[model samples]
Target: MTLTRQVVSFSVIGVCSGALTLVIYVMARDWWSPVVANLVALTAATLFNTEANRRLTFGTPRRRGLAHVQSAVLFAAHYALTSCALLGLGVLVPAPSRTLELTVLLTATLVGTVGRFLLLRGWVFKKAA
Candidate 1:
């Protein structure tokens, strides 16, 4: 697929994944702390996002070991940003409203999405020579 097409596909997937994460967090928050809920949501979305990007966005039909590793590293970076946002919210507001928490998470996720796209396109899923 062309780079443009790949980016478009990735963006669609990213939106779905972000929405999924929010839903997961909302459902999980009832039973788990915000941090733990976010963790679970991120983990679930990462697993699906990696495979979807590999097959649909990057057009890597065959399984590549390095891709999985790269995806994990990408998620780690994303998680770090998200965790910091959560931490900062806690510190800043002490008792931030639920809407505020969700807003912070969505913003963090969007920032991470930009970085993730760069790494996925320019590094992890680069075209073979």
Candidate 2:
């Protein structure tokens, strides 16, 4: 697929997954800590994101197992980035509001999204040559 198409598709999937993450985080936060809630949210979103990107963005749904493993690595990186942002916000604000926390996370996710796209295109979903 062309880079333009890939980007658009990936963005669409990412937006949907991000919304899912936020919804899950909000619900989970009522029962658990922010970190734990974030973890649960990311885990669920990652699974959906990886599969959607494989089929819709990259069109490489043939190797499901390998794609998932590779995406898991990507997920770990994203989780680290987002988690660090949240932690840093906590350190800075002491007791941040939900809006603040979500803002920080959204910013981190946006930054990570660029790297994720590159990795997905050049690494995870690279066409065999």
Candidate 3:
């Protein structure tokens, strides 16, 4: 059941994130635009991720004010790391078109995504002992 939930949860989130990525890429065309777009997407994902992660990923109830705040802070750090990577890729790639830039950024983002998921699993979304 847990594995099933994890797969389903990840799939849903992936689809949601993909949709946001497409919209953002179309709306903003530039080397660094995806970074900006990612920031926007991250904000949206945060809210969705936090709630979903707690219940589905960790079986954690909706934590109240202070715990929520703590989780948000941790999530910010995790998100910033990935966002910065994408921005750095934008600078490093020197791509001529937005499509090319996004390609580079997405490659970088893949590494960051794994890191983020591990961190969230081990730290942010872990069940209380």
Candidate 4:
């Protein structure tokens, strides 16, 4: 059950992120486009990511408990890391080099996705101690 929920959660968010990136790129060609796209992605990621992991992945309810707090904290950390990674990568790779821009975005997504999975598995969405 948890596995199924996790798969769905990840799938939805991943698709949304890809769509968001394409939209942002189409709308703006400035250096700020990547930043804007990432910010939007983080918003969706944080909300759905928290709810899915807390309620579905861990089979928890939206009640006041350690799980709730843990979920918020975990999602917050993910948002922070994602924002930093996207911003830093933008600086390192810049926007004119579309290849580098895409690579950095992909790398940041890969690392952040792994980190979120691990954190949810070991801490936020784990069996309550």
- Name the best candidate (by lDDT): 2
Tens-digit per-residue lDDT, 2-114, candidate 3? 76776577557655765565566556544435556666666665666556666666565545454456667755775577667666765776654656656655665455556
Each candidate: what lDDT?
Answer: 0.91, 0.92, 0.60, 0.61
Clashing pairs in 1: none
lDDT of 2 at 69: 95
State each model's C-alpha RMSD to the native: 1.2, 0.8, 3.5, 4.2
Give the RMSD in angstroms, all C-alphas superposed, for model 4: 4.2
Off by over 4 Å in 1: 62-64
Better of 3 and 4 by TM-score: 3
True-vs-predicted CA distance for residue 60, candidate 4, Å: 2.0
lDDT (tens digit, per residue) of candidate 2 on 1-129: 889999999999999999999999999989988888999999999999999999999997569999999988998999999999998998999989999988998899999999999998999999988
The digit string of per-residue lDDT tens for model 4 on 66-125 reads: 655775675566557656765787666554475565566666666777777677668765
The C-alpha local distance difference test score for the whole of candidate 2 amounts to 0.92
Q: What TM-score should be assigned to candidate 2?
A: 0.97
> In model 4, which regions exceed 4 Å deviation?
2-33, 62-72, 87-94, 97-99
Candidate with the greatest TM-score versus the true structure: 2
How would you encode candidate 1's per-residue C-alpha lDDT over 18-112 as one tens digit per residue? 99999999999889978899999999999889888988998875456789888899989999999899999999999988899999999999999
Each model's TM-score?
0.94, 0.97, 0.65, 0.58
Misplaced by over 4 Å in model 3 are: 1-8, 28-35, 62-90, 93-95
